[model samples]
Target: MLSKLLIGVGAAALCATATISLADTSDKRIALSNNYAGNSWRQAMLASWEKVTGAAVADGTVAEAPAFTTAENQVTEQAAQIQNMILEGYDAIVINAASPDALNGAVKQACDAGIVVVSFDGIVTEPCAYRIAVDFHAMGKVEVEYLATRLDGGDLLEIRGLAGVFVDDEISAGIHEGVAENPQFKIVGSVHGDWAQDVAQKAVAGILPSLPEISAVVTQGGDGYGAAQAFAAAGRPTPLIVMGNRYDEMLWWKEQKDANGYETMSVSIAPGVGTLAFWVAQMILDGKEVPQDLTVPFLTITQDTLEDSLAATQPGGVANVEYSLEDAMAVVSGG
Candidate 1:
């Protein structure tokens, strides 16, 4: 019988060093269901899945691992896809959900069918489904705090993630929390980047002529480099821009540092965590006991650690590190 574990929203920080061994098992059919594929981060995430799952298939740990991407960013569409996966008799489904609450019913159906359902990045709220993610609230707060120190409580431009998504709301709330503590840091303007570089560049460029001088920019991932490009194109002095964990953005930060001693940090969810979720589902299919909710820490890349992150990542990808079975287990166990 399958177990249901409802982890509290305020669970303790995950231990980043706990380890778990992968169980030897026969081939199991796995399906990856993703909501959006419009950004580099999502692209890198899918790439990681392909690479890791390909290796798993070679080792006989997986029978089949096919991925599906939603054309539109619609919850209804994603729900239909999940329903199809359930009808198709998938052994397990790993989802990057479109909405937290929208997919609960479909996820429950998958769980009831004895199909392991695991959601990450953009998560679902179904109690039966396991969720693997970082503390988005903490991620938001930390980025703003870093900006606050550099700006000394000055005006900031907030480049937000997708509107009305779980991660977006949590990160926005965290940014407000940081601003509450630092009254000197005022938000001069806010806009949605939808977590895409081109989208962010267009949005920021359109608004540049109208807004007053800004001291800093706080952005969700996939758009920091775009925002920087916007500032440069507008002939405005680029303020301190806090970066996300995209490869191009980190590369830009490194170049600036080398040329002018520029310093900033990149804080965001790692795209490679998709691989961790894949391993977790395999563990569950292997009948290994795992947590209902596993929290992975944000990939925090500083100037000192940026080069290593860059080295681990590929060109046109996000700066990410893959987690082995042991590393993923440690994140869930918080050991």
Candidate 2:
């Protein structure tokens, strides 16, 4: 009787161990759904996602992380792609939405199907989905405020971002707020850079001939370098250009500061914020509690920190950094 009882206990212990092992080794399939792939920032964001998800695959934390990009900036197409992901049975989906409100229904469908959904950068308005974003309004206010300190009220040219994007609109509104408060600073004109270098250069080049003498240029990211290039090509002294955090822009600004004491500042949404969303999804899969909304602060690169930013950047890439899983958890837990 004693021997039989011992065998029963041992068998129960073995079953418990096997169950735990199976749970540990279970695969989590993740998918990244991006809206547009036109700009370097978007490319860098994709790179960040690839790096993190690749590591997860190696460690058996992720089963798959297939990335998909839309050729055009259309919400309907993105929604359809997401619906396909639902049918394909993705464990999690990270999105850089094309529109804030347009993807709500699809995102809701994903949530209903028991898939974890997280949005960043160009975020979605689906309340059921998790969001990790920087405060763009604050970013805009700060960018304009930094330029205001130097210009002390002058003809500031505003280079807006992609039309109809929530981030672009919020930042523009914040800039207008800053301009309104600082009565000395006046926005003489505005143009759409579409947050691309060549595009911004062409747009600025076209408008420079018609606009009055500008004292400063306030630009969204991916356009600062091009705007400077346009001014240089036009044989005009470049105004105090507040830049976004791009590697090429940082390199240019650093060289200018070294050569001519050209002073400026840069701030933008970090490409690695995508990685933050990746880790957030991983945590949720691991049965860790995370918030519905989380905020990662924007990376602010000034002259003093430019060298460090450059050193941290990958060669031929933008200034980017990824947060570790522990670091992400800290942000989520308010730690």
Candidate 3:
């Protein structure tokens, strides 16, 4: 099994409780080669990198760590970004990749250049690159599992993330797997929301006219509130819409919960998985014997945990949690 790394509780606890001695990497530098930044989660991810890596730099853990994203969420665009990182001569490159395997050549180039490469969230399948992976397939499957408890069988609307991104495919596939296991529910419509609120709102609104009564709107994050908005605007009754951990979505869930005992679950990888990637890259440069593949649990907010999570989250930010040197050491030693 891949080791589970529990760095900290959330952003509020990002303050390092303990520190480990840095390996011979104080002079090294790392760069984040991101593929896209079009949504709240992506924006918060960049912010987390800056927040954690900024402190790491100030403390001389690494000489530098900067994030760069592409204007277009495409394979060639991200491949070019990876190539640029290789040319700049960074000691390590942390990636939220555009494709699972398409950028293997560019990542291999970095590995051949003796540069450490770490991919997270939208991870690459390149064997040479270390991965801080998420169980996105399980993330999707559990959404339907959650719905099954509240909903027996009904028509559904599926709002997916960016088209062609491997994350989207995995999550959607898991949702379908859940439906197959249950056999009571059926998906009536599917659309690409690109993991954006406005895009999701418009897409859901457009499709609501055609879809049969949606019992639950399954999503790939950043689309729950928009789905709710579309239902309200269209004068259709709200369904059990699952949420990604965005502030607005949680807030809307909160309002609905208070007004009536409306209930659903929110789940997503905390955006600070970026900070975990940063520390993992630093650990590799620190000469820690780390596995190439590892997994982190997604944050799930349920009826009972909603208030606490909502309190911990920053306004307009994700419920993120950063990692520390000690946390990385635990992963390295399998503690």
On lDDT, the leading prediction is 3
Q: Write the per-residue lDDT of candidate 2 for residues 1-91, one digit (tens) a residue.
A: 3443354345446556664422231377889999998867788888888888788788877788888998898999999999999989887
Q: Model 3: runs farther than 4 Å from truth?
A: 1-24, 35-39, 68-89, 98-103, 151-155, 162-165, 188-194, 202-214, 233-236, 311-317, 326-335
lDDT of 3 by residue, 11-95 (tens): 1133233234334567788999998999777888898899899999998888999889988888998888888888887889999
Could you estimate the TM-score for every candidate?
0.77, 0.77, 0.76
Per-residue error (Å), model 3, residue 215: 3.7
Candidate lDDT (C-alpha), each: 0.84, 0.85, 0.86
| Count of backbone collisions within predicted model 2 | 1
Candidate 2 CA-lDDT value = 0.85
Which tens-of-lDDT digit does each residue in 80-146 have in candidate 1? 9999999887889999998989899999989887789999888888999998867888888998788
The reply for model 2, stretches above 4 Å from the true place, is 1-27, 35-39, 69-84, 87-89, 148-153, 163-166, 202-214, 233-236, 311-317, 333-335
lDDT of 1 at 104: 94
Clashes of each: 3, 1, 0
Model 1 clashes, total count:
3
Each prediction's RMSD over C-alphas, in Å, is 6.1, 7.4, 7.7
| TM-score for candidate 3 | 0.76
